[model samples]
Target: MATIAPIEYFDEADFDPFVIDDDVFGEIEDPYAIFDRARANGPVQPGTILELLGAPADSIVAGIPQFRVIGHAEVQAVMRNAALFSNDVLKMNLGVTFGDTISAMNPPKHTQVRGLFQSTFMPKQVAKWSETLVDPVVNDLIGRFIGDGRAELVEQFAKRYPFEIIYRQLGLPQRDVQTFHRLAVTLTFNSDYIRYGKEASRKLGVYFQNLLEERRRNPADDLVSLLGQLGGDNGLSDETIVSFFRGLINAAGDTTYRATGCMLMALLENPEQLEAVRQDRSLVPLVLEETLRWNGPIIFTQRMVMQDTELGGVRMPAGAIVNVSMAAANNDPAVHENPRKFDLFRGTKSHFGFGLGPHMCLGQHLARLEMSRALNAILDRLPGLRFDPDMPKPTVKGGLMRTPRDIHVLFDPS
Candidate 1:
């Protein structure tokens, strides 16, 4: 296993504290309410209030006229029309944190990078990892807490399990997983605290740079080694490799934990649904999909207009920033009935939980595999799983990436 020395700290004083305002951070107690209002007024609604109130300083829509796409069809149209609505918004806002990633690129470039990375996460590869890597890791995590009558699922299990899986795949030593997790949290979730996020991003860049160099010198059976071997000939520069790794860490570490945490909260809140899944384990996938539709982690995604275009009969100027509200679209009455209700039996439907179009989440398969395995392990190993009555109930919150802050649950001690 390769080991890189950790950076003690990065200077954040030079970093601007507020690139975007707090209101723009989208930290709403009930995003659905805002989405409902937007949808009621029109599928495409002006976002002046959101911009003036709390848009992040780095927000692409900060000074420009902004619009929100709330209707399901409208959101899909915007997502699918990657040419008209480019992903440059992410590049503009998060270039420093994520570098020139696939999410920020368009067309040929996005295709090249995405194609190279896609093989790493192919369905067969993911299934192999699920059986060999995911199952053991989840079982081990459960074993650590099963003796206790109660456990805080977020801190103890939800956060660590998926992160560890990613770390192992990257071939990093087990000792460094927690360190990477800490840096990832600051990079992904602490964007509101720009100074901290910048510092974390800086350190993470250094960490990956060193790791890539190490892999180049001494080959290993890991993603980093595979990427390193690709070299500049394939358009995989050291800087690009480091950036891709940073993006992967952020996606794998941050999104999975939050999404899984939200899933547990959904099941706990709906005891009958929980019991139903427990009775028939096959329903786990449906429950996961429903949780994503009803209360997915990502609230919205921003896109920059590449050319003048019209959506929902409203004309949008080139360079306008559009906020595609996946959460709202998932709940749109025109698409799903009683969209707010969490129903495992809703059957599979289209959702932006993994996003859509060219820049859709690449690690979605891995995420599902980890989630299903974790859910199954908990059900098999920990009998009678239910929320602990003595503990405060967990609630899903956050404007950008929402998940339960904590899930206190009690189960039969095995």
Candidate 2:
């Protein structure tokens, strides 16, 4: 479509690696050297958005196609262009992971499949679910060590916290909670599955296949069973239902776990912010909102170019991949005043946390409710809770999904 195919393949030795400034953030990092370089050059300039797609995206290594971690208008443009650049990597990577009716689907299919889960995650549904169930569960979890003034929040609580809650919401038998949790861990943590895509896909397909059958026969009053009923309504195959459940399992399990971890870590790092919220307790909303921006759960998401197109004023071709950096766009100096600073009362409710357009996250309300409940319980109960300096820094394992492994908090429980 352009002078050359936008999805141009340059040999490793072809292009000068010195296109942009040096960034040793990780062994392999895309600080979007070209995009950022263009951004650095002028108001509007030539640049490219690099998305880690297919098996290559799974490889976290030096010299990989990580061009740059981009932000600003260029990044937003990518998020906006859902048509040319798609959320259809599920077919490439996530499809094998999440089945069919996921963010990967576009337009009509996306609308149809996503609707089945809409009622379940509706704001009202989440609210009732919270007061009746979620809140008490969180309170109980936090209340365990209220007097001890200590807890291994991540391992003992945060890690499994979202899983258990999801199980309850999906109506999975309580006993099978641990099994689903392990499956989630494997989906997110076991990098080996990433390399062996077929094996991972088969294993996930099989597990969910069995789970879907059980949910069907029992017909429990839960999300999965509801999904079971909606099976094939709009091309929602049994395979799709299975993947949706497993996808739902893998989707929130780590994001919330790491998000809650990051929230705790950020709170500890800024004592004044923590204290402010502890005193008022109402700042939880603003704090959580800011946290979603500052140390957001999702750093970047990949999309593929279906047809030749222009991105950030540069030509892009069919088969090209674009990686949208929510983190960078979030911290864009032009868009956010004092971008680096965390202001709980910033008053902006929107963010890439749930994504944008037709492919927005379906479980957003549930996630928000869960996080809000946990934050309120934490602030209300553990007034003196703060990060222990000696506490180990939480680490995030990256791939299609990114989340922290451990977030140790040392606080006086009471």
Give one digit per residue, the lDDT tens place, for model 2 in 21-104. 011112222232333344565332222232322123244322322223355666666667677777765465566555574767
Clashes of each: 12, 11
Best by lDDT: 1
**How do all models score by TM-score?**
0.92, 0.80
lDDT of 1 at 241: 76
lDDT of each: 0.79, 0.62
Runs in model 2 lying further than 4 Å from the true structure: 1-69, 188-192, 195-201, 232-235, 389-405
Scored by Cα lDDT, where does model 1 land? 0.79
- Measure candidate 2: CA RMSD: 10.2
